[model samples]
Structure formats: C-alpha cells, structure tokens
Target: MSGLLIGYARVSTDEQDLTAQRDALTTLGVAPERIYVDHGLTGTNRARPGLREAMAACRGGDVLVVTKLDRLARSLPDARDIVAELTAREVKLSLGGSVHDPTDPVGRLLFNVLAMVAEFESDLIKMRTREGMKVARAKGRLRGKKPKLSPRQESHLVELHHAGAHTSAELAELFSVARSTVYRAIERARPAAPSAS
Candidate 1:
C-alpha cells in the first residue's frame, strides 16, 4: 500500500482493445505511465515482455492492479507461481477494487479457490471440444485441413516412392509440401498387415 500502484493490462489479439482495462486502472489512481500492457498476446503466453517488465518493476509494498483475475493469468499453476513471486517481493495483487495480500492466509485461500475454478472451467471446455470432435468424426464431418496434394498426385507419388525412383525429400519438393507430408501419404497408402491367428 505504501509503494507505487503499478498496473498491468493484456489483450489476446490485435483486434481486441485494452481501453476498458486502461480506464479502470486509471480510475484506480494508477498513473498512466506506471501501467504495462501486453497487446496482441494471450494470457497463456508466459513469455510476454510487458508482463515480465511489470513483475520486475514490482518491489516491497508495491501493489499490482489488474481489471480482472483472468487478465493476469490463465491457469492455476501459473496463478500460484505469480502469487508466490509477488509474495516473495511483499507485493499485493489488487483485482478490480479488492486487494489480495499473498502473505495473509485468507487472501491466499481466495486466490487458490479462484485459480482452481479457472482450471476447472478450462478442463470443461477441453472435454466439450473433444466430444464435439468425436461427433463430427462419426458424421464424416471432422476431416481436418484439406491435403495439399490431390488423390491422383498422391497415387503417382506413392508409385514413384515404391519404385524407389525418388527420395521423400524429392517428392516433397516436387509436390510443394513438407517432407513429413510425403511420409504420411506413403504410410496411408501401405496395406495394413494381416493379423496372425
């Protein structure tokens, strides 16, 4: 509470705006110059330069303010690591108007609860996505990106490969694709081995 009120803001994409977060921080008496921003970067991206600078700028009694908890971190472990760092430096994290002192048991508990909720929400999203993908696959609608090579070209490529006339690299260069693509096409063309009784 005694040190400077440092603020951090982030937006996930270039199209998103940070105006609301900036205004909120400004309203909280955080000086415009003291605010750090990581524009066009995801909260999941831990190597954000602005975030690193903001953490490094924090010192004893300093308060790090964010408009929301999600704006600060994306996962429970990430949140806990950040809290630990701030605690070690004796810095407080102020979410909106509520100040969380990591040194205090109540504040630590609250932070952990919120982080767990965030992690739970992320897991639900992943599970739902997997289910959706499964359904799409069953319906023959889950085909991924279209192959760079056509079936005719693939057949020709496979024929050439079996004849040992061209290397995988050569086929990839001729087909204008990555060498891995050539390998995958060859693998798919191979007949499945007959199961032994």
Candidate 2:
C-alpha cells in the first residue's frame, strides 16, 4: 500500500552532524517536515523523544524509514520490538536500501532469532554483574559506589527495622538518611533462605 514516507534520524551529540542521515532520508523522498530528529541522545537508550513521536505518528499503511537499522535502534531486541509493533499495526518499517521485510516469513524468522540473541546478551550482562558482585563480596569490598550512609548507620537501620520500633520513613528522618536508603537496608537485611528439601 502507498503510505506516508516518514523518516527518523538521531545523532548522539550536538557536536555530531545529522548530514548523513538527513541526506539519506532526503534521497528516499521523505519530506523535511516529516523527518523526525533527536540530537544528543545515546543509542543505548530507547526512550528517544523524537523517535517516540515518530512512532506515535505512524498508523495503518504508514512507512517508517531510517538510514539504517543502527540508526533506528541500539540493539537487536529494540529493532525487533519496533518492527513487530509496526507490523502489528499494519505499518511498514524499512531502512533506506534494505530488502529485508519483516512482513516476509523469512524476515520474521530472522527477526525472532536476532531478538533471542539480544535477550541472551542481556542475560549475559546480568550474569556478569552477579559474578562481579560475587567476586566483590569475596573481597569484602562489593566494588561499587558505596552506600550513602556509613555501615554503622545502615546496620542500625536494619536493626531498627527488624525490631519494628521505627518505620522506614521514621528511620530515615531519625538517622538523617534518605527514605530509599532505609528501604534498601531493610531489603539487604531481609531473610532470603534457600529452599528446604
């Protein structure tokens, strides 16, 4: 179906030029007004304001264009999620010269596989973080930005929370601590017993 040729462009910093992306979309016949641009946003974040606007502006029979897949999203899951949503809503998403069509059976299968790989990568990040924490714990350092409160204060908070003598808010106020700190302390102190056979 013939649809509006809407384009999205992003540059990580104000210092970076959007010339490449802009020229690409221009070549694709996307109007200047229909081109959405976000400046100074890192690709690691999917919450781009202009990108969100472009997605919201899309409707059935609309075509979303980007210079490339990387310009559209930072990761496989991000690409797949956006493509899936567009496909679901009867919108078509394409990079300027890509023959890959998510609506095609093969493309859909490939998208699913890529999405799984992205999920695995995310799991790997978590596993590495847990392992890092384990090593840090073993070293008695935890290798992170330390707590805002001193260990003694946090220990006191946990004790008070356990004794049920003070609510978290009260503890925070009494100890000159943030409410979040008191809550976190309680969580750290809460029992997490292993499953009994």
Candidate 3:
C-alpha cells in the first residue's frame, strides 16, 4: 500500500464512551495500529497530539479518517485549512464513512460547500452570543454570571443569623436554596460579628 488508512477518534468529556466510534472505524476498514484516539478534549481545540501526529504522518495518497468532520474540527475555516493542506500533498479526506478525495472535481466541490457551511455556523454563533448579551443587559442584568448573593438577600440572611431562629439547614430549606448557600451566608455574616475579633 502506497498510503496507510488511519483513523482518528475523540470524545470531549470523561464520562463519554468512544466504543461506538472505534467500532465504526473498524468496520470502515481501519486497524487498531493505524488509529489515534483522544479522550476528554473539546472538539474546538486543535492542539490534540494524536491528531497532529496523524496529519503529519499523512503523505501523498494517504487517507485521514474521522467519524465526523465536527469531531476533527469545530469551525469551517480550520477544516478548510486542513483540507487544503491535505489536498496540496495529494492526500484524501474521509469523514463519516465517506471517501472524499479532493483530487476529483466532485469531491472538491463537496469540500468547498462543507467549508462554507462551517464558517457560516461560526458566524451565526457569534451573532447569537452578541444578541443574547444585549437582551440580558437591557433587563438590568450584568450580562455575565450572577452574583452568589444579592445585597438584599445577604442583609436578610445576616439578620436571621443574629436572631438565632433558624439553623443553616433550616435557613436553606426556608429560602429554597442549597445547604452550601446557607453555609456561605453564615460565613459572610459571621466575620462582621463582634466575636470574630
């Protein structure tokens, strides 16, 4: 064989299982020795060591296999860059069990369309993020993570602590908050008391 048929697989979180992907790639004719796998890494990241190694090992007429294009790259621009590089070296790009060789005009067109869609998806995400922030800001929200405690709630918590009427667990129950919240409230109020000195 002039080129090796290699497979690359990944899953973002530790809890996720990659058995299915491995099985699919095996059925697609890739062997364990030629497979590179990564676990608990985000799809948006390009710094995967195994991925880099596979790409570097790819020579003229080699195949770079991925279960899905998204599993290989997050956005369209990056996909295009990788695809372009592979095409320049006479490499083939295969995804989701499909053989796509850029040397052929039909495959080239498919790659181009896929790249465009990826770029468009990224732009849409950015635009939605901006609009979401705008909406939150308009409603007097800070447009980021909310504070652990509001000023009014903190004051009430402090007063209750002084009264000694409710235990931390009881306060959590009363306020419909977590036990951790009650503990945090007590800590925040405790320092201000005269006995802490």
Candidate 4:
C-alpha cells in the first residue's frame, strides 16, 4: 500500500538537536511540511502536540517514521498501545531505516520482543534506584529535596501558620514559598501526642 511518507522528530530538551532527525527524513524524501516535530518535550510524555498532529494526519497505507524507536515511546506499554492503534488503522511504522508492517506475524512478534526488552530495562533502572535509596537511608542521608526556605524562614513560617491569623496562601506569600511548602512545614511542626497504653 502506497501513501504519504510522514516523519516525526522530537527532542527532550532545548539543548538537543532536531537537525539530524529532520535531515534524515528529508534525505528519505519526506517533505519538510509533512514532518512534525515536538521541541523541548520529553518522550515519556504521551501528550506531545506534534505526535498528535502526525497521528491525526495518518491514513490507511501511510507510514509513521521515526529516526529511533525511543523518539516514539519511552515505555513498553506506551509502545504497545501505539502499535495497536496504528495496526487497527492499517498504518505502518518505520524505525531507523526499517519499515515494520504490523499486519505481518513476524513483525508483530519482533515488535513485542523489543517492547519486553524495553520494559525489562525500565524495571532494572527502578530496581537500581530503590537499592540506592535504601543504602542512603541506612546512612541517614536519604531525605526529601532540600527546603527552599532557610531554617530561620521555616521557623517563622511555622510560627505564622500556628498563629491561625494567616491563611496558608498568606503564609506562603509572606515566606516567599509555595503554599504546599507552607503546609508541609506546618505539618512538620505538629506536636507529638502523649503515648497511648
């Protein structure tokens, strides 16, 4: 099936380059206008405007192309869901330089295998992070992000909050911090109750 050859390009940060992906698609003869791009947006975010536009633009026999698979999805479930949608619409996917036909059993198997590998890699990262956090906690080094307000400021914040004269918003504004920060500080300042039998 022959139709438009569409391309999608994405960069997670402003510092990264979209030139390479754009050039590759252009070299492959995809018109510059047909190529959609999302700048400074993370791949983990599924609500990318450019991606939405590209998908909306797709029709049966059309191909969705990406320079890399990660540019399309960052997780296994996300990849699987997207492939499922494309297959339902009879749209093909082109990754790197290979065109993958989701209708073919072999291609479906290959994509599912890649999705599982991606999931495994994601799980390994989470496991490593948990281990690191556990070690840090054992050393009394694991903690929430450093407070934006200093100790003196925090004390004043707690004082103002306890006075019951100011709203949390007022306290936050007075302390030049977010209302959530003021609430957290107030919570931390709660007195311990007498022990129960």
Candidate with top TM-score is 3
lDDT of 2 by residue, 126-194 (tens): 689899889889998976677788888777777767677888789989988789888887777666312
| Model 4 TM-score, 2 decimals | 0.59
lDDT (tens digit, per residue) of candidate 3 on 1-197 = 66778888888778999899888888888887888888898656778887888888788988889888767776666787788888898888789779887668998788677766756765776789899888888987865667667888877876787788888888777777888987887787676876533
Per-residue error at 164 for model 2, in Å?
A: 69
Q: Model 4 shows how many backbone clashes?
A: 0
Candidate 1's residue-wise lDDT over 36-140, tens digit each? 999998666789998999999999999999988778887888988998889888898999979987768998899888878767766776789899999989998
Query: Ranking by lDDT, best first?
Result: 1, 4, 3, 2
Candidate 3, run of 10 with poorest lDDT: 188-197
Better of 1 and 4 by TM-score: 1
What is the Å distance of residue 196 in model 3 from its true position? Answer: 16
The weakest ten consecutive residues by lDDT in model 4 span: 188-197
Look at candidate 3 and tell me the lDDT of residue 88: 91
Best by lDDT: 1
**For each candidate, what TM-score against the reference?**
0.62, 0.54, 0.63, 0.59
The TM-score measured for candidate 3 stands at 0.63
Candidates by TM-score, descending order? 3, 1, 4, 2
Question: Candidate 2's C-alpha lDDT?
Answer: 0.78
